[model samples]
Target: MARPTFRELTAQALSSVEHGYDLLAPKFDHTPYRTPDRVLNATVRVLRPYGPFGTGLDLCCGTGAGARVLRAVCRKRMTGLDFSAGMLDRARSAAPDGTWVRGNALALPFAPGSFDLVVSFGAHGHFLPRERPRLFAAVRTALRPGGRFAFPLAAPARPGTPAYWSLLAFDTAMRVRNAVWRPPFVMYYRTWPLTDVRRELRAAGFGVTLHPLSELGVRPDGSPRCRLVLATRLPEHSG
Candidate 1:
């Protein structure tokens, strides 16, 4: 069968929330918006050195993109969690071998130290900056002592590029949508800056490190275009 056109995919991705993804669910695997296999491979490569983990959790595991990665890195079991039922349904179908739980990232249903490793992909934009502390805390509680939470962060778009303008416009529109609409969608591409994220991670008890995803290549300024943030929880301080 032929691939769905970009127009069809965009129409589904941008239209009604559930219907949009419901339409895109099947072809989501074929889209570039899905984290590329190369990125996933690199994540596994970087995480393998730290792993041989018992259980892993994929936060906001949209369409099971990172769940597949977690399955490879995790030695025992993998679970994918997300808030959207539609997305979870698709992810469950795609990854029937893995566990799928539908829940908000803010209030993860897992107990403290339940997982040995936690990872997320392409979903941070769904969270606001203020929510990072709670989100990080939840993830921290979800992992065992010294367990790591990792994700890839792309370089900020250059100021003059179309990507930059598009992100600005999208954020503006989302702000407008939230102002006028009830139960906002709340996704913004520009809100989660890396510097702020690092501070938030530290505040939430993670000792963070950045590893360059060198295969993605560097920017014109000689900095990595994409890098992974690996945040490891420190051993709990006993009073």
Candidate 2:
């Protein structure tokens, strides 16, 4: 966030979401928009047991943080796909060894069963709830039979807590901004509940499973702070 100056942030806020990302791409790594290294590291460790995966895909790879997970786990080719040309340029430059694809997540440009593993991070907020089914279907289609799609989801903060209020305020602000703005920047903090997401994934043909990311620890109630959603594309003959 600090990477973009006030003028730059204002410009992005006033622009459409896609163009906003394009504007922010060069300095995205220095901003909070970039996925944290810790989250990426934790994912690598958590997924190591589930993988020794062949080909891998990183969906909506902003600047290739999740590509590290693909690189670590996959034995074969690694690919990063994103809608933003500026972001894809940065990803390609940063991770030269991997393939960089510029395309929409809702309609992934790949053959069916193209990848053994697929991972996305911090991109769910951009998709409205109604769009999730299509988005997930694309991911499901891109994966091989028995391929796994994974991402981290945090437990909702308790009501009246600072985190809860902060997210509420952000969502409210976004709603108001969209209502008044010419082109809306669709970002929501609280829309993607785990139960709803799981249902959507299941509807899209994934067998959903949850793995608590122990490295991030649990909240006071002992619920994990975050858990990884491991959704597998079932094989044709599997019971």
The lDDT leader among the candidates is 2
Residue 154 error, candidate 2, Å: 1.0
Instruction: List the candidates' TM-scores in order.
Output: 0.90, 0.96
lDDT of 1 by residue, 118-229 (tens): 9999888778888989999999989989899999999899998999999999999878876886556667889888999999899888999999999899988899989999
Clashes of 1: 0
User: What is the C-alpha lDDT profile of model 2 across 10-81, one tens digit per residue?
Assistant: 898888988998999988898777888888888998899988999999999988888889989999999999
Name the TM-score of candidate 2: 0.96
Q: What is the C-alpha RMSD of each candidate to the true structure, in Å?
A: 2.5, 1.6
Worst 10 residues of 1 by lDDT: 10-19
Per-candidate Cα lDDT values, in order, are 0.85, 0.90
